[model samples]
Target: ARRHALRDGVAIVPAAMPSQANVVSLRMPLALYGIAGIDEIHDSVIEAQAISKGDGIKGRAHHVVDSQGASRIGRYGWKADIATLKDMVANAFANELGIT
Candidate 1:
């Protein structure tokens, strides 16, 4: 079951240097922040807006819940799915390293 789960969890995404790499690695560390800090950063980021007739693109902060059940802005992952640095680290350990 664990092996199957790991196999399914692996994702293959396109890269700029296709010949050099196959999978994107979690090489960088996410900055740690308190609940208030996360909220502050989230508020500072530009809110998501609808595309206008001539608008190009707009990005919005993804909202997520922390391990403690508090709401927070997702600051990790490509889709902003992970809520906090601690969560991200734990996820990496469990999924990538099978440490859990």
Candidate 2:
């Protein structure tokens, strides 16, 4: 993919999710990482803020629900309450490659 992007004269930037290991390194409790199901999405939003707070990352971290006011979290891939920018990029890739 890098080669194809280079050959096509396109700029490529890969966004990375903060790994479980990294999240753990922030010194949050184990239970924090265990929150995963859709019901825990709101909890994850709070967790993000707490983790970022622990890590001293500035700015707020909160879930932005869609027009329907639903917090989806990990439902469609990626973390947070809704489809992230990375989700959109990956969906575009899937569409282009007809992956599903």
Candidate 3:
């Protein structure tokens, strides 16, 4: 019963047996933390507005409130809905472990 296998230096694991329960098909990758701070992301948003491209797509900053009720620019989630790493971890605790 080989549940896990490794090939080409990559870990090949078994799929979720619960049928679509832990499967992510269209998930977008987020940048690693410590690479840029919240202030840097916000600054990028500001700099993006100064671009003078040919009617290019404009980027919008998504703001979310953290657990401490502090407003912050979202850096996680599909639409940047999650604000901080702490908030994302808390959400995982509630959704995955059923802990509020």
The candidate maximizing TM-score is 3
lDDT of 2: 0.48
lDDT (10s digit) by residue, model 2, range 12-78: 6777876753532343422423333444345466556555456557543445554345553333433
Which tens-of-lDDT digit does each residue in 1-100 have in candidate 3?
Answer: 5454465465757765796567566755455567436534563665577566778765677767878898776776778787777777678779866997
- Output the better candidate (2/3) by TM-score: 3
What lDDT is obtained when candidate 3 is compared to the true structure?
0.68
Measured on C-alpha atoms, candidate 1 has an lDDT of 0.67
After superposition, candidate 3 runs with Cα above 4 Å error: 1-55
Please identify which of the two predictions, 1 or 2, would achieve the higher lDDT against the true structure: 1
* RMSD, one per candidate, in order: 12.8, 14.8, 11.1
Q: Estimate each model's TM-score.
A: 0.47, 0.24, 0.48
lDDT of each: 0.67, 0.48, 0.68
Worst 10 residues of 3 by lDDT: 35-44
Q: Give every collision pair in model 2.
A: 73-81
CA error at residue 22 for candidate 2, angstroms: 42
